[model samples]
Target: MPPGPERFVGRERELRELRADIDTPSLDALRGRPAATCRVLLVAGRPGSGRTALALRLAREQAARYPEGLLYAALTDPQGEPRAAREVAAQLLRGLGREADDDPEAALREALRERRVLLVLDDAASGEQVAPLLPHGETALVVATSRGPLAGVADVRPCTLGGLQSAACVELLAQAIGSTRVTCDPRAAETLAERCGGSPAALRLMAGWLADRPGMSVTDAVRVLPDDDATPLERAFGVVAAQLPGPAARLMRMLVLAPGALVDAHLASALAGCALEAARDALEDFARYGLLRRDPGPGAGTEPAAYRVAGWAVPLLRDALEAGERAEEVRLARARMLERTVRLVRACAASAAAPDEAATDEVPLALRFADREAASGWLRRRLPELLGAARIAVADGELDTLARRLASAAVLALDAHGQAAPERYELHGLLLEVAERRGPDRERAAALINLGDLDAAAGRTKDAVARYRAALDAARAGRDAFTLGRALEALGDSHLELGDRERAADWYGRALAQRGERGELADAARLHTRLALLHTDDGRRDAALREWRAAAAAYRRLRDHAGYAATLAEVALAQEVSGAAEESLRTGQEALRWARQADDARLQRVVLLGMARVLERLGDTEGARLQREAADGLAGPGDARDS
Candidate 1:
């Protein structure tokens, strides 16, 4: 047996079928057809469903019967360069040690007649390409696999493989991530199984990836895994290129050029340049043909779901889109795709914190209430397509408007989702190009601010500061005070991350002054609080207290109770640091009330600890003891903080 780690799991029924096909009928008359009658077996299954695996496994198991050897050949005919049956036969003959140059059909028949061989013709384009490869006599057993039913082969036992069972999927995960890890967390295992769609190839790929990253948890892996629909989606769309009739196929190719994953019936209608019903009919036809997967529309009764090209066919759809003669149609398709992607990004970026009912105000009506996970999923899966579209738009040069929109959309997607963000290279590269190409200084500044903030979150402090500086300059040049204030604050945060307390204080102070003049109360208050922390670090206790007091009043006026409470905690800290024992004790107690009311346990604990230290310094030993007890209670379970 092979190593258990690599051994096949699931498919006991399929294995039994293959075994029954191979076994000769017993001498008993009731046993029916003998294995000799099963000379040709066609194993049919969908792409990536393990047909190839079954064929190889069955061939290996029966190797003893065919002592000569086995031959395998691929028969799919790629477009504009179709692989012919003659070529396949000639190749199989050569694998059997015969000259391929000899008359292909004669060589195949002569070679098979000479010995006991097992032949596997994989991915046959159609039944006709497979007929010539069939054995003429019982000297050999032949197996062929295809996406669809392969007719014309008489008496061939067909074994079609479906996805693995859920249990088998779990077993595959255990093999991939090790049994101990999976068994430790059964839920993660099940989630992984469900997400893999029970496809052995996908399971094996995921497992191999997990096995290499020993410390990565199964749960974390599941969280990061792309939706099951992605690959199959590409495959389904690929067939649009191969299987659709002329104009419909052209429409599909155009659809693939779409920027984001989705293309609504209206826009798809426009791109296909057909009437609404005709376009809708084409989309439905594509769905019926499995060329695209439908995204359930909102409250539309699910009868008229929005559709996008499926995942697996993405590449094929792409090739077709790029290959067709309608250059103008392709260009327009690219423009539309960019336009939609930009719209999504703008909506997400602008309204990330919006209440659900109002979130769609800035977004497309179809996209409102679309789960963040699904939106982010589409963006991540089609990231390459998104980036490619942007680059193409840029290269077209004349479509600078489309390029700007694409660049901004890419930036927005990145802004809203961090690790799950679309590709970084495209977001930044395209933004830089668009910024240089256009004179919209404020727009350029806004894009830079987003890029800088993203860099700061990603821990690229220096790069983040550089972006912030450029944004600040652009904002100043555009006389945009709002953008300038935001940029300065971001720059301050970046410097704070680098531990440059003085420069961080200077930046925040400038931001605060500008925000104050403009009544940017919320921002100005936050900046004041940040500046106070630096003052305390430098031992300017009075200055720190004054700044915190000013910030607290600002937050209070703005009705930001949480912000006011946070400022109080900071004030309590500065007082203790400055040795104002009595004042610190009073301030901490007042801060505790606000923190607790805020319902933030983390903040409450910080205030409790501050009170304990303040009482200790004020020589109130018993009072300090009580505060320590309260702090410990708020701290909850082990304070190790070590994951």
Candidate 2:
């Protein structure tokens, strides 16, 4: 079982009842029946009612009894879409060390038939998804958690979880905020818990808020927690939000526009158009109020923490955003957010292309970082928020240019980080929608090309080809060589992935020519490298060498020592493969020298290993051994190779 909260303080009675139900055999099983055998326990609750947490805790406590194995699966994706039953079954099969057959459900059921396994199905959407995954044997136990009761399923024991008891709520608060704080004013603590409707989620948030303010007493908390006629959770969130300072309150409302679960101070600063320090302070303030929860920053050192609005607080904050005067504030905040996000994402792209030791002047002073690593870290941490801001920007209609730039920069950052999940495809679709609606042909072409790239990455070559063709048309309409070259190249790559080598070569040639005509040396160099790989795949060694040499020269001209070194390494490998061992040795040596200049240990290692193999081919056993040792030494601990 995964770890539960550090301080679990409630649900003893529910836990006892659950244990009793698990130990008690079903009436049908008692009659020695095989048809209605397996024991199924359904734990149902609302979104933030700690349903998953309690389920996990029970699983951990009872794990020892099930000797076969413990299997778990989330029946829904993070976006709350119901995950396909086949996918969930596949997960279970993998857990059981078995490959899923055509019918994953059947496979999983069969695997668990004779085993006393504990299977946990979390966040189940409907009975259909749960029914097929249930264990068929009497020995096995299945725990299915859902927001509502699985009324459609037969012969299942149901356990409905509600808010914590008052005592439990107070205990949870004390556990989170500290005993001294709660014990200092026991009556006030109980009042706070009862006012929060004894909901563990609400209590936890309130406790976290109080924890952040060491000087704040329980009485002070109760005094500030306003009275409201709304739902208990909503009223509790309102009371917390009402007590926050003006800037912090405004920031909380703006956070409703943030996409996804987490945001960093940089994003907050952008959204609020405030100083980074002020943005961070506001976030900390919200954390103190339990309106937000903090997570460790992306990288090491003193990086600002990431935060998410408390689950219960989100709807309330969103309500504030859409209601009355706050609506206009949301509009301006989103615009500022889009502007700042675009600039930061652009900086991320620039840093990835040419990592530098110092921040560039082009980056806003507030957004600048110490180096490329810091910039990239910021981008990685904030990609979801950036994508979210892009969606909001597109929806706003007037920020079309900002939306286009944000989409372009975000796509670049995603590519740089090699993130090719469903979210990337979704973002590209959003970008395409915005581009087609309000952007120029160039932006539309870029969006289309990005979509093509995503399709290619997912191995949908035909779809990618279609998108690239559409992109080419848009690029032609715009008469932009950069966009045209990219579309042509993507078309070539998609066809190549589909194994149409002839068409791939033809498209590559056109793109190369277009880039050359437009003096896009970097792009041309990249195309040359692609062509080189294509030729090599077709056993055209001499052609590959020619392309590699062209690529190396372009990198050298641009003073990109890293790219030059990498291209040189490829050139040397081609030389060795073509029986030019002596030339390969010298080229490999030159590659290593450039790798050193670029301070790329990974590149240096590659060059050394290549040289070692070439030396072995040249019958210099001692030289080969020396190079191998040097390469191995570079692989020692603390090398920290780039991804």
Evaluate all candidate structures by whole-model CA lDDT and list the values in order.
Answer: 0.67, 0.77
Model 1 TM-score, 2 decimals: 0.50
Clashing pairs in 2: 209-288
Writing each residue's lDDT as its tens digit, candidate 1 over 94-153 gives 455454443576678766775788887777767777777776656687777777776775
Q: TM-scores of all models?
A: 0.50, 0.61
lDDT for position 157 in model 1:
70
> Which candidate achieves the best TM-score against the true structure?
2
Off by over 4 Å in 2: 1-7, 16-43, 52-145, 150-158, 173-195, 204-229, 296-304, 343-385, 418-423, 481-643
Model 2 lDDT tens row, 130-208: 8888878678888888988786677777889888888888788877778998888999998987777777666766776
